[model samples]
Target: MNMHNTSSPVTSKPEELVPSRYALKIGDIDVMVVSDGVLPLPTAMLAHNVDPSARAAWLKEMFLPPDAFDWALNAVVVRSGSQTILVDAGLGFDPDLHLPRAGQLIKRLEAAGIDLSSVTDVVLTHMHMDHVGGLLVDGVKERLRKDLRIHVAAAEVKFWDAPDFSHVSMPPGFPDALRSAAKRFVKEYGSQLRQFDEEHEVAPGVVVRRTGGHTPGHSVVRVASGGDRLMFAGDAVFAVGFEHPEWYNGFEHDPEEAARVRVQLFKELVETKGLLVATHLPFPSVGRVAADGDAFRWVPVFWDY
Candidate 1:
């Protein structure tokens, strides 16, 4: 877990807060791990199925604080030839949210010398605010990019679009805001929206596979070229999810389904030895999931690049 330090051009009293971004190669595609910021959640908000005491003990064993966990808001950028594809834009600019560490994705992308308009495709893993928020400009309803095609799970769009569809897993009264966001997203990008039902290819080397349960149509993106392969596992597994695929987060729409998908995806990754780019493992979350007995472990990539 030797995370690389990608510097931020800002200063503070003790030390400068650095924003992280990393680049790696997946066959012919050039992939960049960009950060939006870190989202901290109380440990009490984590486990929905497991006993609280047991979960807390495990956290303590891992040398983590008994109170909170810092989850990274990471997004991926994939470039092949002339095409630039973005996976799950981070939390958009929202001053009201008061999440100081989040909402830095666009700034990090710009700092990396990536042109905002050059992004040709936006492949949304799910319609979570943390993921799709960056699609809109700072506090504005307008889209950040007008020409890029937006791809999302058909099931996801249908689930969020239904008037009667109430999200049970979110905090009380939060579902309304989420539903409104989804509708706004649809209204803004419906003309450019491309929805897929099952495993479908977005580009020559990029494929989206449905791994539902986190959301109705949550997906994992697979990018393959030559003999190299990489999996952009969007919200399928967090760092702890690797060791306890059976234990699901409170936000999981269907905990059982999410666990099932996690186990299956982890096994497949172990068998294939594919590089995993997770959204919430650690900052610049690129790693490999290996079988640890019946469970799994995250062996993060150690490249300095």
Candidate 2:
């Protein structure tokens, strides 16, 4: 959910830079994570943390700079008949996250022709800049509809809404913009909030489940249609290339615990043939987890509808 940050915001507008990315369609449901744009991850630094040979191969094949790394930020959108849900809202002009190709979530949303007022529900897995960035429009609370069923995990609600959550709030830890949105959510729109826990149905085929480790209250949603299922795994894995099941992002507050959940969930995903939709594993983020060698490989499928 957390993208590496700089103290200052990027001057380049997201729409002016990276063209929004998309990959859509699955069964009776049409799913896509419209891109907010890409973020520059330090390649040399990230590679140093990864397997050198794998890093080298990706540097050549994946078009990554030998010295720097860049990753696309894609927040998910699910459409089942008239029920449209955005899983994670993208980066919303936060000066703190200091991202190039930033603040493109709404444009991507508009490209999909989904009206802000018509969004029936917004399932938030956890509150992170890239994940919840589009929740509040740039500098305006009224821009985001309060009538939408803003689904949040019970554990997440307790933490972000808790008085102690202020340290992580904006202003203190470079999240000044989000702090305002978070405060507005806790106060005026509290009635629109409908709390959920692990393994509960939010919509007809949409269900939320706990996959803690990334964040204390972090969860994933399973959208089932015509016997097929697609899972929205928010920040469970970053970087499009797959690696050891124990692989994790450095920003995960709890790497060990996240790894455990990943290992277990991956096993289930392999068995179910469920679509593994990672927020950061390239745009559209649609893939299938397969047993490659001793670990797993993320097979990014070319999806269209």
Tell me the tens digit of each residue's lDDT in model 2 across 149-233. 8787777667665423321212234444445556655565578777877767777788878777777678888889888888888
Q: Write the per-residue lDDT of candidate 1 for residues 36-125, one digit (tens) a residue.
A: 888777675467567889889889888888888778888998886777899998877556555687878877777777767778888999
Instruction: List RMSD in Å for every model shown.
Output: 3.8, 7.4
Q: What is the lDDT of residue 120 in candidate 1?
A: 84
- Overall local distance difference test of candidate 2: 0.67
Model 1 CA lDDT for position 126: 90
Q: Count the backbone clashes (under 3 Å) in each candidate.
A: 0, 5
Measured with C-alpha atoms, the lDDT of residue 43 in candidate 2 is 58
Compared to the true structure, candidate 1 yields what TM-score?
A: 0.89
Instruction: List per-prediction Cα lDDT, in the order shown.
Output: 0.78, 0.67
Tell me how far the alpha carbon of residue 190 in candidate 2 is from the true structure, in angstroms, after superposition: 3.4
**Model 2, 247: alpha-carbon shift in Å?**
3.4
Spell out the clash pairs found in candidate 1.
Answer: none
